[model samples]
Target: MHDLPARLPGAQRNLLLKHLPEPRMLCTMRSVKLLPGTAFFTGRRSFAAGVSKEAEPLKKLVYISQSNDVFTNLALEDWLYKQGDFKNSRALLLWRNSPCVVVGRHQNPWVEANADFCAEKRIPIARRNSGGGTVYHDLGNLNCTFFTSRDEYDRKANLEMIRTAVWDTYGLDLVVNKRDDIEWRGQKVSGTAAKLGRDVAYHHCTVLVHSDRSMLQKALRTGGVKGGYESKATISVPAKTACLREAEPSARVSDVMNAIGRVFLQNPIEDKHGNTVPSEAGGYQLLNPSDYWFPGLGSTRRDLASWDWVYGKTPNFSFSRTYSLPKAHNAGNNPQEHGIASVTVTLHVTNGMVTETEIKENDSFSQTGGSDLMHISALKGQRFTEHLLDAAVQRTVSAAMNAYPRGSSGNHRAFSPGPRLTQRSLIMESERNHDPMDREYVNSILTCA
Candidate 1:
């Protein structure tokens, strides 16, 4: 045998020295040839091989699902980031939702929602966890979610990938509009949002190809004076919104979805650990709970649907404003009944501003009587503003407190300050409502701060 000194490198020799195991036993059954130089080199090779075997391999391809609701999709994406599930996998989520208006997580829903219009049409209003403006969606809309480990997540690159996928499948040159939307020609076709987490991030977009345009318009009211019920809310600019059918006249929702799937399948990349990763690869799945219908879907629909979550979460406060109006004769047969109207209004509020207001009729001898009372009541819970509060006070004077027809009266009286609650409070309540053993369920989902 060759001498070990002739083959073993100095670094390898030093490494062996550092990790040398304790000498335990020696056997002397047979006479063996002493190969002075070969033992060290052979031992070093064995050590190197052992270290390689001990290392863990990286995971690739993360399975994701298409959700049926926008809120559920947003919630699940938030859940994935908090769970650190994106540490080593890439996710593809498919999702859709009923006709509704969705506001960016940081946006004010009141401003984004057309309360009068939405209420008339019975469109649901929801807030997402991502940062963006308001968007409308229906069954015809398709939502896509892309999830990746925090270290590997790249918002710009991911967006490009999506743009490329659409272009490849439809042969349409879709441009990223306003940096947050995808547009065909000059009209917006998709609205995008993103949420970042400690170990992962998610980017989702609403594809309004074949969505119901009329319902979308009805669900999202575009024009309204800013303030009061509409204060600080996101407003959609008037635009001739079009569906994929209207735009292409030949494209369908399924056609776009299929095209997306094809693009992802055709393009694959290697993950951080050098493992080959596939896009839109099948194997993506979701963990179905005992109640699959609501699996991963929270009780938000029920809780938020309740007046408790909807209005009860508002902060506590009040608004006060004084107004003076010139006297005028009644248009009816009562000229002598005409008199100057003077009013001082006080409103109760909660949350960040006035969520509810209570108007105290300070002067009983005023000409408008309780006519102004109806208008003051409407001002409650509305954000405090010089202009809005003044207008509300004026409406009260015009109607003459009693002039507000019964039933025609705004439901301002129906609002009540029940309890002060937050997202945390709701989660706690949900846990108490379930079995103690399932507390983990609450813990797992309560990850969103």
Candidate 2:
């Protein structure tokens, strides 16, 4: 382990103080002094000290944020990921989220999580620019990120520091499995993933503090798969996960984080007998990520939080599922009140939009499942996105309606119920008042796929 205790003594020797210009400082109003060895700095969380305006290379530093907003916290990491010359510096970021499910960069959101549940509960699904299986987060979960140059990207060493810190502080035995996951007894305590840049790389991991296990599992599951889905998108592997509090009932996130920081600081600044200790100057810098503190921080957060990055980046994938249509085929009918026939929904999405779709309505609109829809050529070029799916469905319904006779009550009762099941009604039926599992199926079927 790095001799942290020996490294922190002079951690702040070169500290310089600087304050943001009054006009752009939305979060802070006072001038702040930068931390020792300070060079570049930037947040709204709280400042242990301030940031230096100098260009000197900073030594190892530690930061802890009070923001639990996943988007904001993840954005904070973005600053470290894209900025700074990490070659000679090591910085650690500790954060937590309110309650969310974060997926890897290349994974499929539809396949990796219960997107419907998250949406219904107003819980956001965030995408981090790293490759790893899905992980659930809540206030009980602590995120630890270590930033270093590509040459110094050592995940095992970082994991060891956390493991050792917990053990050394609480006398708990945590095992490091072959995958580098930290386990208590046989259950996982932490899971890690990383992102590599041209020069800098960061390894971030989730430390289960006292998370809601039920929600974690529910959020990570694809809910109930109607039929099946196949994709090259990374699939999440199941592991027995336990929280730090499980082993030490009294453990707190702040304390655990501090313990880890202590171990990092204890690393010898020089050799085993070196006189310098970086921790003396190094302390937790509280940051609320903002453009004022870290330039472009907001944009990075927005990019990460945007639909394009969160869902559009998903690897091209397909879902083939069978569902049942309601009997009330009429526009004003309550889908849940009547029994209908079986239907198949096949969606081929690329860039998280509808590239190709096949919806076979066994009992479509009480008609013979029209042959006219054959050449509708479908939403092949538009986004099959979460929020946009309904609009697409509206367009499809309009086209299909137009294909039918107007005032057709004369011959086809199917064509006459238009007034009751207006465009809005159809949209709601598929989204609500049905089995949540098949809601998406209903919505896509209406896309006339």
Candidate 3:
């Protein structure tokens, strides 16, 4: 190490010695090579043209988010990726959110999350700009997003830093698997997803510190039957997950956050023969997610929290479900004689709106005016809601009964399907009706939350 510095001129050697006083510290400063006529070498590459054209040194940054709202953090990330400069700098953002479920860009929320359950639990669901599987987040989980220029983005290096942080801080050995997930004892402790833009790219991951496993399972696992969906959307691969606290009893969310922040700023160094070591440091800052802090961030947050981006962005898909029509919606057919009439509803949704709706009835239902009941073109452009499925039944059944008034056998009273309701009118009517359950159902499907 001393010899390397001696190779430089007197002024350069003196400056080098000033920064790195101890001999051992000089050895750790291997990134600072002795380039001729260069006072302090920083970048990994040699100067292409001359010393005057040498690029600026890479600046490592660790930013801790002040907001725990998922939408705010997501918007902050989006804003930084679109607006911030990372030409000669790398950033790592550490954040956590209140209980929420974040789905990937191309993933379906109905397939990725249990909507009715999440709605009842009041857990907001959001879709990020990145493409990957869905993940459940809460205060117990820690999120780390590594940002760099498109050419400088190194996902493996970021994962290595996280792996080294866990090993160094908690003495827990974690390995980066083929899927780029961090695993400990064959159980996932972290999940990775990334987005690569033309000029910028970011690799963000979730670190399960002491997250609620039960809630994670409930939030991620979709309930009800699953075979109806037919789409090219990305499906989440469920893995056996373990938390950092489970492996190291002493580990806490704050401790892991600080450890990752420290590791990120220090920028871990790898030695020959594949050994890890500590190296030089960088800057750290705490970022607050607000309009005052980040201008134009409010609009991005609103978009992320909007239904158009969250659910409307889902890939085109078809869903089929068999629903038993209510006795009143039997189209004047006697249920005791016809056995309960069930309709097979097949919906083709494109851009979150119903492009086509096909309802197939059984032989018992076909005995009545099933053809009239199948023509539900009125719901052509409406937003999807399994809860409002009964509306379709009523619409079709009213048409069937009105087509043949004397075909009725039941003593049921007169029924009305009322006016056709679009997505906006459905919510407004639900609110105006002041029915708590109806409003809750509408909110479950219509609201972004």
lDDT of each: 0.51, 0.65, 0.70
What TM-score against the true fold does each predicted structure earn? 0.58, 0.70, 0.72
Which portions of model 2 miss their true places by more than 4 Å? 1-36, 43-58, 222-227, 269-281, 323-343, 359-382, 385-449
lDDT score, residue 121, model 2? 78
Return the top candidate by lDDT.
Answer: 3
Put the candidates in lDDT order, highest first: 3, 2, 1
lDDT for predicted candidate 3 compared with the true structure? 0.70
TM-score of 2: 0.70
- Candidate 3 wrongly placed segments (more than 4 Å): 1-55, 222-227, 268-280, 324-342, 362-368, 371-377, 394-449
State the lDDT of candidate 3 residue by residue for 91-168, as single tens digits: 788999999999999898888897878998999999999999999999999999988788767788889988988999
Over 4 Å off in model 1, which ranges? 1-67, 223-240, 270-296, 300-337, 340-349, 352-449
* TM match of model 3 to true structure: 0.72
Question: In angstroms, how far off is 244's CA in candidate 3?
Answer: 0.9
Query: Best-fitting candidate, measured by TM-score?
Result: 3
Candidate with better lDDT, 2 vs 3: 3
